[model samples]
Target: MYKIENLSFKYEKDKYALKDINMDFSKGDIIGVIGENGCGKSTLFMNMTGILKPNSGEIRYNDEKIKYGKKDLYNLRKKVGIVFQDPEKQIFYSKVYDDIAFTMRNIGMNEEDIKKRVEKALEAVNGSEFIDKPVQFLSYGQKKRVAIASVIAMQNETVLLDEPTSGLDPRSTDAVVDIIKNMKKNGTKVVISSHDMDLIYEICDYVYVMNKGEIIKAGNPDDVFMDEKMIKNAGLKTPWIIKIYNELKNNELKNGETKEETNLKTIKTKFAQYK
Candidate 1:
């Protein structure tokens, strides 16, 4: 639904926050951008979502180039929504229902439709109980869910989730993952920016590894994560599943596949004596 070509962004005279980045977000995929802190993952998201224009390249949404004019951006943002890494940056309303309804109201949706959208968005985030609660009273995770609910209420065809699971506990993170999957099931393109490798490995259909504001590797998860040298150079570690398969199989990449189930079956064969 989105095409980013030769995109580059600079924050200062000589340094680029994002350099020569290109990405495609099809209608039904979970794309992951993985890198260390200060690696420009967030910067890339900003440019793609039209919050920050690129210094050199262009971004297209649904085959049309994105223009940053006031009216242009207003319409673009309606199709491409983003949830920030910190919920505070996105959550502006004191109450849950208001926050989720904020975007729809901005577009002048009737009250009845806004209420139904609010309820459905809250349900997707598993936050129905929070609909009437004060935003300040919710925990950090709950606040994050509310922030996501606000974005989901927009029902954008493409969604950018900046560190969606950051600072979240396992249960909360899993909830976020499930919500993301549901977005895909409902036909939204989900682009995730995170440093968490395991989460990327498990949920992402594709990945790009970045360092120093440049993407050093791009491919399906197996090709991107299984390259130990590339992962190390990117200042990230392979996911635990890959690590286990390597240790159990004497560090050899087996049959050119590193998926969880494939690796698990390999590990089981090594300990077949347990049977």
Candidate 2:
């Protein structure tokens, strides 16, 4: 489990990036963190992964407190893998296979073991066919998959993804979403930071809505999306289905129906009834 208690950060002494943030994430949870730009969503992830230290707070993995020492930080980083928003920033080695094997090699894994693990990771992301291809030759989506493969090769217990679907076509978005679902099935704690409402509704089991460096609300997807005012206040819009449902509720435009009878399928059926 990952736990943050009273976490806070300030880029300058007078300006705060994150304020009194606290939350807990457990295995088998796909959490979506959303907010407007500069709400400190990325800052929070950076702190948890030890890329940035909090001005005052505690970040704990399991029950042990994390220390800032180089050795301890290295261990923590190995356990928590982060996929940046831009895939290009994470790719470095000449070939796809070498990039995926880079992290394992850095940690001093044996040659034979590294090869075996690299193959498995590639297979996980459906990239085994391109093992020898130069990363620069691969398309944007393929490079993203290779980036993910690199992290999976590390075998981390927790994965933090920053905008995994930022600049991809619909097909690539679906591919990345499939990988995230697979991670949850395997009991890895996956936390995603995204602005895509449809993606959140489709995959996230829980969500934390942030605004101005604070988490304003958190709950199941349906619960959080139902609050239109709270959602808009945080610089987000409700999903289309929820927005339609809300409008129907407010206008009393029921075809001999009540609010209690409305649900995802029911809403779809109602909208279809008009067509």
Candidate 3:
């Protein structure tokens, strides 16, 4: 639903934050952006959400070029919501409910609809039980949930999450992932950046590997991860699933079994049988 062409951005005169970035995001696709720190994942999201305008090139959503004009920018933001990497940076209200309701209120949504949406958004992030809790009292993971709730309450067609699973325990990471799945189920296209290789491999339909402000590789998870050199150069590791699959292939070959290429599902099933 969104297309970016030759996008370039420079924070300083001599340093470019993004360079000739091009991406086409379609409905129902969970796109993953993976790279080390300062690789411009957040910069790309900022430009996509109109928080930062590219110095050159264009972004088109549903065939219309995105402009910074008042109405156009407002409409673009309404369609695309971004959740920053740090929850503390985004959660301004003291209460969880109020923080989530902040956006709806600004848009002049009535109390009745706002209440329903607030509850629904919190529920989507599995934060309903702590709906009225003080933001300061919530855990870092809880604050992250609240941050996601704020975006969900906006009902944007696209959600951009920067390192959604960072700084959380396994349960919290799983919870954040569930939120991504729910967003996809609700037909909200999601573009997420994470250092978690396994999480990206598990949920993302397509992946973009970024290095030094440019995408080095972009493809389905298997194809992108297959390039070990590029993956390493981008400061990422191969997914555990791929590692195990390769091990299984080696074992089968050593045992004189037929060496067949296996997909994740087949490898999982075979591993279960082996166990």
Q: Cα lDDT of all candidates, in order?
A: 0.87, 0.87, 0.89
Model 3 Cα displacement at 176 (Å)? 1.0
Taking all chains together, the TM-score of candidate 3 against the true structure is 0.94
Cα distance off (Å), candidate 1, residue 131: 0.5
Each prediction's TM-score versus the true structure: 0.91, 0.92, 0.94
lDDT (tens digit, per residue) of candidate 2 on 58-83: 98998888888999989988888999
Residues 104-141, model 3: lDDT tens digits: 89888999999999999998988899788999999999
User: Model 1 Cα RMSD, Å?
Assistant: 4.4
Per-candidate clash tally: 0, 0, 0
Q: After superposition, how far is residue 192 of candidate 2 from its true place, in Å?
A: 0.3
lDDT by residue for model 1 (1-275), tens: 78888988999989999989887766229999999999999888888878888999889888999898999999988888899999999888899999889889988999999999999999999999999999999999999899888888998988899999999999999999899999989988899998889889878988988899988988888788779998998889888877887775663455534444345656546646553
Model 2 TM-score, 2 decimals:
0.92
Candidate 1 ranges beyond 4 A from true positions: 251-275
